[model samples]
Target: MANRIHPTAVIGDGVELGDNNDIGPYAVIVGPTVIGSDNWIGPHCVIGTPASDRGAPHPAAWHDAPVGDPEQDGFGVRIGDGNRIREFFSVHQGTKRPTTIGSNGYFLRSAHVAHDCRIGDGVTLGSNVVVGGHSEVWSLANLGLGVVVHQHSRIGPGAMVGMGAAVTREVPPFTISRGVPARVTGMNVVGLSRRGVSPEAIAELEPYVIQGAGELPELPAELAKLLTEWAREGHRGEH
Candidate 1:
């Protein structure tokens, strides 16, 4: 199949696009950008472009840093296959490194992934969600609308960040976090089950649900026994 770029779109020099990508009307894509196959870029979305550096010399601002020389090198955006970036969603290329979006991820309308953010596969960011620069969202994690993830924090695999939550610390795997400071409500049982987690693993994980600790304490004795049994029984690959 041939590449189809809308006549109103502005595709910059050195940009690389794979087959069957639909570039929306008036959307701008600047290079050093590489977009993979079957991705949908919605109308008026600006990609692979640096945010305008408008702040004064704060000594810590990206525009004032010493690494600013060779400006565009090592800085741009790379998106994998089958991702959908919706209308008006602004995804900026990195200032110091590449902004990487994994395959099968969905960015809803008005969602913003700031520079240098790493989003893993099958993740979904709801409308108006913001991911700070340098933050890592692991595979299959879902962030509800208006969630704010601080830079440098890690959101673990299969985690769910509730709407309006502010995450400052690491969100553990298979859990749901909500509220202002983001407390864990419970295990992400539905998410785990949908991914085919074994009944034994769920049973194994059930007894150690201690509060204040987001996940099970590092393989406690009872949980470990079940895990060992599950592994020995050849059912360790579901989740």
Candidate 2:
């Protein structure tokens, strides 16, 4: 089926939009961008814009340069299928590589995704949530309204960030985080259950959750592996 783009919507050169897209009035889609099928792009939303730091000076001189050819330059936004990007949402293109959003994501009104961010499938960013540049939000992670995630941080899979929280560190999988600096509150029991995680698995992950953000204890193979991976990534300063 053909895309239903509103008459007032502005689609810039080099923009690649797939079939069955519904682009609302006044939505601006700039090119070097790839948007897949069945996306509901709301009014006043902007996608594939150049990074905010395009004017900042760097030793390589490429940092301040404008996006010339999106495809050739390999700098743009890549959105997968079935996303609902609501009104006033703005997603910036990558400065070097492409900023990517996986399938079935929901970005609520006024949510902003900065340059070079990686958003996984089934993720939900509530209204007014701001994800800084180069952040990675894993699959099924939910950020409540007004949440602010620091740049280069990693939000693990099935994590739930409370409303109005400021996340400065990496959130573990199936965890609930809140407060100003966003400390781990507990295991995301409800979230895990909703995801169909077995009671046994939840039990297996309980000890680490009780221990909080510090050193984790030895756990079952799967849980231990995940915690170990998170620890290794944490040591690399990704938080």
Candidate 3:
């Protein structure tokens, strides 16, 4: 099927769009961007703009960034298939690399994805959710309405942040967090169950969530691996 792009929509030069996309009226997609199939880009959405790095000494400083194009430097957004980007959503490009959104994302109205973010598959960013620069949201994570994530933090796979939470640190996989500073409240048992994770596996991982736990209990192989990786990444201060 052919792509349905509205005449009022502005698709810039060098933009690559795959089949069956529906670009809404007045949606502005700028160049060096690649969008995959079956995306619903809603009205007034702006994509592939330059990163908002105003702290750089000079305007031309972004030109010399390590990654991205020298000529069209800082102007690239890569979006995968089957995304529903609602009205007024905006996504900026990277300073060094492309800001990437994985497949099957549901970005609600006025959701903002800032520069260099790596959003994984099946992610849901609720209305007015704002993700700061360079943050990584893992697969199947859900950010509730008006949630704000700080720069360089990681939201783990299957994690859920409650409404209006201010996330300042890394959220562990399959955890539920809420509050101004976003403290880990409990395991994401419901989320894991919905994903078909066994009850035993959930039980095994529960001990890890206890505060001040110096040692991890013996867990399933997959859970153990995930915990190890999470610890390593947390140690690197990626939050």
Measured with C-alpha atoms, the lDDT of residue 20 in candidate 1 is: 90
Question: What overall lDDT, based on C-alpha atoms, would model 1 receive against the true structure?
Answer: 0.73
| Ranking 1 against 2 by TM-score, winner | 2
Cα lDDT, model 2, residue 28: 83
What is the lDDT, from 0 to 100, of the residue 225 in candidate 2?
58
Residue 63 C-alpha lDDT in model 2: 23
User: On a 0 to 100 scale, what is the lDDT of residue 197 in model 1?
Assistant: 66
Candidate 3 lDDT by residue in tens digits, 1-239? 89999999988765789999999999988756799999999999988766787774223222232334634664468999999999999998777678999999999999999988999889999999999999999878999999999999889877899999999978877789999999888889887776566787677666554342445555546555656766676532212
Question: Candidate 3 overall Cα lDDT vs. reference?
Answer: 0.82
- Per-residue lDDT, model 3, residue 10, is 85
Give the higher-lDDT candidate: 1 or 2.
2
Residue pairs with clashing backbones, model 2 = none
Give model 1's clash tally.
0
Order of models, best TM-score first: 3, 2, 1
The digit string of per-residue lDDT tens for model 2 on 1-239 reads: 99999999988876889999999999988766789999999999988776889584222112233436665765788999999999999988887678999999999999999998999889999999999999989878899999999999889877899999999978877788999999888789897676566777787665554444344544445445555665566532222
Candidate 3: count of backbone clashes, pairs at least 3 residues apart or interchain:
0
Error of 3 at 44 (Å): 0.8
